[model samples]
Target: MTDLDYRLEDFLSQVELEICEYLNKQKTKFPNSSKLLKRFTKRKDDWIHVSNHFRELKAKEKLGCKENSKSKEKTKLQDNIIIRNNELAEVVNELCIAKLFVEDITIDSIEYEPIVFKGDKSIDFHLRFIDGQTAYCDVKTIHPDDTGNWEQYQRALKNKLFPSHASFDLQQDSLGGILWHHSFASRTKMLEHVIEFEEKIVQKAINSSRKIMLFCGDGFRLSKDELEDFADFYYTEKYRKDDFMQLMEAYSMEKEAIILLRNIDYIAYFERKPMNLEYKFIPRVHGSASI
Candidate 1:
């Protein structure tokens, strides 16, 4: 599509297509990975509407059954599937947002993940802004697969994928986010992850001379009541408003939060300038929009 005719959905759809093709081609090597893509794409809408697999698993674990059955194994496998799919979803979401950033703040062309940076790491996107500033972008995700017997793959995930993906050495400036997608399995887990990240990661980025973005996960495709309920879960009982405030202090405006709709490959990025609480998702392309 021409630049004038291109939309966000088109970019996202292409990403989705690429992911599906990769999974399909690598099914023999990564059976669970390919199965996850197929399973989610087939019924993504239903999964989003009733996205409580984690809660259900917790409830089952609370039972503390000591039985060794195929059913139990199956349940555990499904849980792993949910985690992996959510993690992979973050990659597609990040790339789409990279395209958006290129269009928004950039003046020249941007390159995708390429191996020509510090530590020989592959920075996600490198672009030049309208004001002649360059940005080295990177997207990071933490998801360790559980069911896999592939020890090598797990090692690579921990060693190569996580540590080597940083965009530390900047040509001029930097732009990136530490994606907290599928890094945790529960609210308590999320709290722990957030604390560790804040203590170690957030401050360093804030102190950096370059711009950094933090994309926290908001994978819920909830109704109005559900969204409000979630807000209460965090702000009221969990005291997450303080965390939000701290995050604002660190990565405030250019301030972005992301959400995927109930169905389809579309993702919405909510942004606010100067980070003054006037946040909205800025009307991105929906599943039914013309591409």
Candidate 2:
């Protein structure tokens, strides 16, 4: 719904700072969903696709007037602003993490949206360590979805395993979908990625020197009951503290793996822990995310 209250906003590059400012400017346009979706998509019908349920609601009315069309279009838009804000929210979330990441190692040399070698995998931000080491970084903002998330699963893994899909050739650069997370989805899905990785690719991320970090936008931040429901669904099999601890331990053994869950006003940093370590900060406006 909003952004983490991040200090040092200037840490963002000029372009990124402009992007954030642009989002701020567009907040004035927020109450309008049709125009918001248009800002994101070039196609006229794409706006409807983003808020298709509204169309169904309008259709169900059995009677529609052109005079009310404009009002009706803007009606459901406000309630669904989160959906409209996904892409932009992700970029802002990444900028927040990038600032922290850059300061962590105190590296000044940086590049944004660079292509990685061994494949065409594009990183959100690339950094050259002070020691002259290089790491490919990708930022993710995962949300709670019940649609089986098969769509992202398919897109993330399709090319890695399917060779005949020529477009995948560009994606073959040691890319993997199995996230080493303070996993939001739980073991079944993570295990599926493990199985798929072993079946299609041989590289073990834990064995590599690269650092992988996952940043869950404010979208992933949930209240107690919502978290419980999410856990019930995510850990559909069992909710064992011991199992989760073991998983976190495994993820931590990696060189520079981090899993952060941040909200508009607080951030919960998880390394190897039964629970996340949380800290409060200023609250920024809320928004959305994809992967």
Candidate 3:
């Protein structure tokens, strides 16, 4: 199977496990909780369908079929679109855990295509804090494979066309990769919206200023050279150096709030062996919490 196929399988397995755990907890709350139990039980059939579909896709991949060809691959890709949806669910879970919120929050709480400007669009989470204050949290997930793609994406952003990718689907399209290249622009727009949202949230924080917490995975930070490459790619002759400097300053100021919880760190926290990527850049903010 392709790497994408393997990732999809891993993601689905995790989702199934999470669903089972949720049902188990609910069962403990009410011994004869037929309502929730029955709902989950019904989902079992759907999960089976998903598994069978994946098995068929795997068989095709083994036979060396065209990755993005129509037929089983396309069908499988469409069927497995839920994988990305599940990833979004995971992001929401991580956000809640990191933010220490008791209430159930979800990706559905986020507004997509929030506003369309001349150059960009935005997606942001509207989170309600424990202290009755609402904060707009912008969550970003980066993969180890993002360095090169991110540079290309930053270029697409300048042209005002966002590249799209079918990361959730089985059929990998070059067009999608091209679209993925546009992510940098889209993300830049998202960040701009986040700044505005942060201002509003800060104003709403009754007792204190609103906090903008950027929960990033290991892929978020790169080596100094990689960062410089991305900066060079995104910045133009007029604003390249200045933009790069401003970004560094901003990063320095918000280093504390910008948590780089790497995958290895996560594995280590869970008592597993550290995986890879040894000499990475990990800057920690010291002193005050405010940026």
Candidate 4:
């Protein structure tokens, strides 16, 4: 095998080992709970995905040269795995976003956790483009709490208002699963809820002043089959305008929020997958943009 290829495979193996060790330690610490073990088992691809991207960064020398397996702080994924699932996803989003730039010929190099101004404030990534231009990028994952969906879903669960046939373990099930199960309710209500949810997300998203904003979410995961269906539909002009408009309205930015978004150069969404990393950069619009 080529040396570069060997290095990539070696890096992936090292990351996998580190993850196994970490999760095993967690399992030992919480013997009564199999949640950590179960999570790592089921979501093992997530670490692999991050590791692949990280290897790409390392290969391109885009990591600013300080990061290595031994340095926990420099290794963003290692330091981030200590928190909750959403936090873990956020770190994954950052690495995946970095991978996108690393692969892009327009980008020259990348720096993680770059300090752009005074105080302790920092952006998640600093991208130096090939044309001598640079941009500060930050990753934000819209948590279920950001839209009050978690609380509402919990209330629905407590009141036994969720679908009768739905079978879910509260701690083990994802918020996306709950939403999908409850999606059989009134269409109008669902549309309104979606719009309100997007409004809340857009409001929260505007709080960042970085040159680039990358928004991702735990509930926003799409299966490979679903992505295939979307790809087919995307290539065809079969989508109805009214339906598209309704979707846009559901995810549309508020008029006041437009000003905040306009201040940023670009905004993108991380199209999360269980085993893949894909991104969709939203084009700049005059007054309306979808989340």
Candidate 5:
């Protein structure tokens, strides 16, 4: 075989190995490995092209070409794919933990993929918190770099129009309420999901006498504006003017109590260094908590 062909084969092998390693370490169960293998084999073709180019230059006695391409820029695409996959795996692990936590809190039927409103969408987990009350939980992964986008979502929630997503609909039903936990990462997309989730799902839960709690696993922070926005939004959307006034009166009469749980231990690893963490709680007007 030519040098280009040999090098192309080597690159394909490495890509396949890396993909398999990731799948195994993440403990993913694929319904059909053969199908996935074929899909990945097609993806490997892109890398093979790069490898072949490098090999061609080497055969031509180019000074810069070594076993791999000398240009660092060529690897950027591959590097990004690797980074994204790593982040996804970390997020999955955190979701597993959140799932376990939900199970611990309730003995009621713990259902995954619970059908809602005759659609393909389904809630991640639904728990019966108590007699005649159910808690719905949706797990989201956020990356810290996207805080600004999440801030926008918090604003949208106050306005009552949520950006569309399949999972959002499942939590919107008039029955059990929703609880959204940022499983891992703190990206804008995750924050957006939370905002839409609160407005579309959790608020519905609160309306039905169920409560909502937002769990930020670790290494994530929320600004004052974000918290205040959440509080104002929940109050306005969830309660009528008179009921809100009654709640304020009750808080004053009872000497308003705030339960703060700081730095609760949960499993998460920062994808970058020197990670800073923040958590804020916004109490809903009628004794519901938003964080």
Candidate 6:
């Protein structure tokens, strides 16, 4: 095998080993009736399958068991599982993105979850380019809500939009809400949310003379079958690239959020696959457009 292939295989092997060790530790923590315990024991060895499996496990855990136990105790345990599982998925995404830059002559190296400043939040990656330039990328998983809660239902009712991706048709209805298309609508909404939420990080990157990047994960909770055809199943196939680019260009000029959008250098998207990163540049302008 090539050096790059070996490196990837080694990295994946190490990750699987770590997961096994963690499960071994959890073996004695819960009772025989614990669903989480059963899940860990039954987890498949496939990398892609395991990723989606954890998410499914999380969803099932949320539905929870009806056993007679203290409410607080069950809530606490469930919360901990959710948080820990999320961390696993986040780390996987970071590592996969890092692999994209491996062997690229332009990038000298990548530091995962680096501490950029003292007493401040850290982005997912810090890339040192060979030409003495640097960039910071923060990876985010973008997925639709599946809680089916009353509040979510209310919001869907008001907005007339929801998320239900089976055949990529917006005609589907679930709980009295029309499914929202990820490529057509969610992409813009996700970008707006990121700008609002990561304002400080973007500002800090700008202040420090560093290029800012947002790596948004578009593939989340996809089934193994869907992942097999991920290239066509992902957001790109649902809409035109030029049309979305035009939409973003227009949205970037809005008066209120122009400052934030102008400073964000790059916004990249991926389908949870190695070497599949796609860049979507957010244009920087001197001034905002008038209302």
lDDT of 5 at 157: 52
Q: Please list all clashing residue pairs in model 5, or write none if there are none.
A: 142-185, 142-186, 142-187, 143-185, 143-186, 143-187, 144-186, 177-205
* Runs in model 6 lying further than 4 Å from the true structure: 1-68, 114-120, 149-193, 196-198, 201-210, 218-261, 273-291
Task: Give the TM-score comparing model 2 with the true structure, all chains together.
Answer: 0.36
Candidate 5 residue 59 Cα shift, in angstroms, is 18
Please report the candidate that would top lDDT against the real structure.
Answer: 6
Tens digits of lDDT, candidate 6, 106-129: 877666555445464456566777
- Stretches of candidate 2 exceeding 4 Å from the true structure: 1-82, 116-121, 146-209, 217-241, 244-291
lDDT of 2 by residue, 52-160 (tens): 6555555656566445665666576645644544444444455444445544644535555554334533444555667866544444454433223334445534434
Residue 196, candidate 5: C-alpha displacement in angstroms: 3.7
Which 10 successive residues of model 2 have the least lDDT summed?
266-275
How far residue 269's Cα lies from its native spot in candidate 5, in Å, is 16
Cα-lDDT of candidate 6: 0.43
- Candidate order by TM-score, decreasing, is 6, 4, 2, 5, 3, 1
Candidate scoring better on TM-score of 1 and 6: 6
Which candidate leads the pack in TM-score? 6
Q: Candidate 3, which segments miss by more than 4 Å at Cα?
A: 1-89, 92-193, 199-209, 220-291
Lowest summed lDDT across 10 adjacent residues in model 1 is found at 170-179
Candidate-wise lDDT, in order: 0.36, 0.36, 0.36, 0.43, 0.37, 0.43
Give a tens-digit lDDT track for model 3, residues 1-291: 556556645654554455444434543222333433343345544555665666676677779875566365667665464654344433433322322322244211222222233443232334444456544444443322322364444443464332232112211244444334333333343244334444444344423423333333333232233233333322221213322233433344376464221111101000101121122222221212221
Q: Estimate the TM-score of every prediction.
A: 0.34, 0.36, 0.35, 0.38, 0.35, 0.47
Residues 166-191 of candidate 1 have per-residue lDDT tens digits of 21221212211112212212222333
**Which tens-of-lDDT digit does each residue in 77-169 have in candidate 5?**
446444543343333333333334333534334444343433433344455644757655554433343222344333435654332321122
